[model samples]
Target: MLRADVRAARKRLTGRIRTTPVFHTSVNGPNGQVPVTLKLEYLQHGGTFKVRGSLNAMLAADPAADRVIIASGGNAGIAAALAAAALGISCTVVVPESAPHTKVAAMWSHGAEVLWHGTTYAEAHRYATDLAAERNALPLHAFDLPAVVAGVGVVGLELEEQVRGRPPILVAVGGGGLMAGIAAALGRRRQVIGVEPEGMPILRAALSADRPVEVGASGLVADGLWASRIGDIALDVARRYGVRSVLVSDDAIAAARDYLWREFRIVVELAGAAALAAVQSGVYAPPAGERPVIVLCGANAELGG
Candidate 1:
């Protein structure tokens, strides 16, 4: 998707979603305290940034369509359900058994018909695709579609106004939709770094292979970051924009989550902390004077003390 498409998506979702805030802070790094900006997108509606794309896609579709179907690990399904609720359409979300109960409950609370299928998101997606055809429901992909990718690109546009200079952006990737959108929107204006769980480095693997390839998903944040393969559309955008990928360990991800809560009193899911983990763990280091912006993408998982 192009920058113009992202602007059109922003127009379509003007009043539907929240323009989340950005906060500046100094984080303890291998060298010293590294200054950084955190885009607080976890505060977004449906408890994640997925709502931006979900709302935009639903709005662009025919209003007369009664049913919409999607498969998600968690965040995207909740976003789709909330969007469908707002549009007064029926939504059915098929999620893998490994999905967090908190997310499934949130979808149910949003009035969506929830189905538990398969052990992994990829398996659930296959089931959802078949069900969508059987039900004749308008299928909404969690990522990979042009409209969804364009809608997510709006985050980059918002950041342009929020950040003073074009700072390198670190974003967590699952299916690569959010990273692709941001890369497309920013378009070489800023460096886009994609972070993923070491165990589920779908985008990293895809980039290395020069195409989408299946990867095993086994990590603390598997539910959110577990995509067997990166989407084709996302891969194309990443290649076009020269986006780079990094891998973070589950240990680092857990530490980042704890650090966010202990230091900033901010709570985020495992996937949400992946980007920060890259910096905190020294996997993706920035220049001494450069202050990179990290996108805190979601907080949909259950909070435990």
Candidate 2:
């Protein structure tokens, strides 16, 4: 998607979604403690950035369409359900069995007909696609459509205007939609670095292979970043924009999650903490004098007492 598309999405999504706030904070960087900007996307509707795309897609869908369907690991399904409910349309979400119960319950609370199938998101996605065809319903992809990516690009537009000066951005990648959208929005003006869990480095693997390929997804945060393969649209945008990819270990992710909770009182999920883990673990060291921004992508974790 182009910058123009992102701008149009911003206008279309006006009053429909919240412009998540950005907070300045100090984190343990590679060279001792350093300042960083945190985009609190976890506070977004549906508790994730997925709402932007899902809502935009629904708005652009045919008015005659009465039903929507999607398959997600968790956050995206919740987004679709919320959007469908707001639009007064019927929605059915099919999630993998591994999806967290809290997420499924959230979808149900949002008035979506939820179903569980398969062991992985890919399998669930296939089932959802077939079901959509059978039901003649519009299918909303989690991160692989032009409108969805363009909708997500609005985050980059907001960040560019919010942050002082042009700073490199670190974003956690799942199917690579968020990274691609941000990179497309910023173009070559700012660096967009994608962070992935070591156990589910689909974007990193796709970048190395110069194409999307299937990879195993298993780790502390697999539920959010468990896409078996990166989307073709995301890969193409990353290549065109020269987006950098880094992988962080599960230990580092857990540590980063704890740090955010203890130090910042930010209860973000593992996927949201992955970007911070890159800096905290020295996996992605920023250049001296260059300020970096980290996108806290989600906050759907169950924090128990």
Candidate 3:
């Protein structure tokens, strides 16, 4: 089911979006990985890879769509807002009060009517989902939707085409949409590692217990990882497919953020750091001579934006 959806998603998003760059980063890490491919999706439009899903969602919707609404921690909202602006459609985004100001500003700058509701992404999602139903508007979910996940799978398409045949693995699991979609795109040929923050171990707990359990932990990375529950669609993808989950420390993620800035000069947010954290902390180490890949998904971190 997911594979079919992903194929349709790829066809739906062929030239609608830019295939972000994937690179073999040769820099110093906390560990001694000679070269790990880094999919610089941080360089995605609107400052994150979220544009892929947003544009795909918009394309999947009817052209005469009355309105669109979305709930997000930050990156997804910004992506949706930008897409709406391009299409000249009315978009209202529900965000949590806890979301960083930079993310809020990014959405507002794209002419999205921003609504601060609830205390976290899950709460905001509930509000936004209900509100969309009331208005008969399209609800652009942050990650749960098949369209959204398939849109994210485009990242895998780009990686596979760019990195020869059969890349080692992909490490980027927040909201699980990114991993689920990418895993679907790559099929069972490549390893898709689900990396999550230790503070908010959504996938780790889910894979361990073999079911989606709620253990919501709050952090700056909440926008990326504080999803109270896993997406049933995405979780089912991981289960039916072969997706491995790993947990990384918040401190390791912080160090990764700093390392990327100092080493690669790439100023990415905590979300992008999660993948690197998995590799550096030995939580999901690659086999000998196996070329591992990390998808640097989004970069919306700001100290005081």
**Model 2 ranges off by over 4 Å:** 221-225
Which window of ten consecutive residues has the lowest lDDT sum in model 3? 217-226
Write candidate 2's Cα lDDT for 37-146 as tens digits: 99999999989999999888888876656899999988899999998999899999999988888889999999999998898888899999999999999999999988
TM-score, predicted candidate 1 vs. hidden true structure: 0.96
Candidate 1 regions with alpha-carbon error over 4 angstroms: 221-225
Query: What's the lDDT for all of these models?
Result: 0.89, 0.89, 0.79
lDDT tens digits, residue span 85-173, model 3:
98788999998888778889999999999999988787888899999999999998888887788887888777877887575665666
Give per-residue CA lDDT, model 1, range 155-208, as digits (tens).
999999999988899999988999989998889999999998888888888889
Count of clashing residue pairs in every prediction: 0, 0, 0
> Candidate 3 clashing pairs?
none
